[model samples]
Target: MAVKLATAMALFAVGITTGCQGMSEQATNADSKLDLAVSQALAEKDFRLYYTTGRRPVVPGFEQLAFKELEAQCGVKAMPGTGDTLRSEADKKARSEAYQYAREFNIKMYEACLNRR
Candidate 1:
């Protein structure tokens, strides 16, 4: 699963570069495709577009909205992570594991929200 996600992320990064180069042509030719791409990218938590365009990719309050809606449907909050509020990493390996687990939970919640839509 990690390998597949890494591959997808690589491809998306490449696409972002190419897409920006021909911005005008792509905008005219692929408006609908662009819309769908944006939808799936958000659903799948792919934020390479933001990196390439220097734009804020997600809508304001998106996380809060998702938390509320998913809680209503799933009877639990979709947010994960330890919050790491302390800003201290006592163990590097443990922190890495926690980050990986949080990423997986994010993907799962993204898919669930997409299905609900």
Candidate 2:
């Protein structure tokens, strides 16, 4: 009986540890996806701006000008980073939603800018 109880407990602990590791991997993947999405959106925006205006997008002052234009014309605000601390599931969800919003907003602004040019 004692051996059986100990074996069962050991298996249970291993299962819990495996489950926790899977959850951590999932969270890391989620964060990576968010970062990739944001990066792609910014790249698209920069490309469109350069194509329309015939100006390089990487100049620091010009980038700030584009951001300010986005703010004024699209009423978009900068999205804040999650910083160094671990985020809860709810926080991750909210950040994902915010990123989606910003991405969509920037795309719309790009369209409007292209149309005006």
Candidate 3:
């Protein structure tokens, strides 16, 4: 009975490790897809269209999944902030800072995903 229990525990550990490896592979693929999307957008000058239409860049589903996985792994907490009603220079500066922070956050998420398992 003890030997059987030990074998079961070993199998469970192997299963978990295999599952993590699969997830890591998927995350790597997701990361590649994100890079491709960014390259395509840059090549197409999508930023200009976004600016004209006031539409933000779309995050692909795989990227979103990878980000979610990274967020879970990193235990990142989101901070909610209130936007200023007036568009003063200070407000604009704050908004710019917020965007920088957002980009940094996403980059971290991507790195985390790529580093998984």
Candidate 4:
């Protein structure tokens, strides 16, 4: 009976290892997708800044600076408080869309990692 139980455990382990052969590629792909999303965000921010003030968004540290301070922190490139603009609203919407995509992809990534056992 003990030998039978050990055999079952060994077979289960081998089955699990065999099942996870493709998991690494899936995770790398998801990480790549996430990186692309971040790049897109950076590009959109750059374009918006250029369209409004002909400059790119500035970051003092690893953290980001807010849009309101752009006029002051970014010098003349960030002048004239535009108040609220159509593009600002559109940009917010687009960012929300990106967030949703990231969330979905991250969930899949999590599931893939969990199943790798």
Tell me the whole-model lDDT of each prediction, alpha carbons only: 0.47, 0.52, 0.48, 0.45
lDDT leader: 2
lDDT of 2 at 94: 68
Candidate 1 residue runs with Cα over 4 Å from true position? 1-66, 77-84, 91-96, 112-117
- Compared with the true structure, model 2 gives a TM-score of 0.38
> Tens-digit lDDT track for model 3 on 60-83?
222344444544454333323323
RMSD of each: 17.0, 11.4, 16.3, 15.3
| Model 2 Cα lDDT, one tens digit per residue, 38-76 | 567556654332211113322122344565564444334
Please report how far candidate 3 places residue 85 from its true position, in Å. 35
**Candidate 3: lDDT of 1?**
100
What stretches of model 2 exceed 4 Å from their correct place? 46-117
- Stretches of candidate 4 off by over 4 Å are 44-101, 104-117
Ranking by lDDT: 2, 3, 1, 4
What TM-score against the true fold does each predicted structure earn? 0.27, 0.38, 0.41, 0.34
Instruction: Judging by TM-score against the true structure, name the best candidate.
Output: 3
Question: lDDT tens string, model 1, 1-117?
Answer: 999999999999999989887997755555565456556756665442110011222212233454445444533332223333434566445545544444444454446555654
What's model 3's overall lDDT? 0.48
* Window of ten residues with lowest summed lDDT in model 2: 51-60
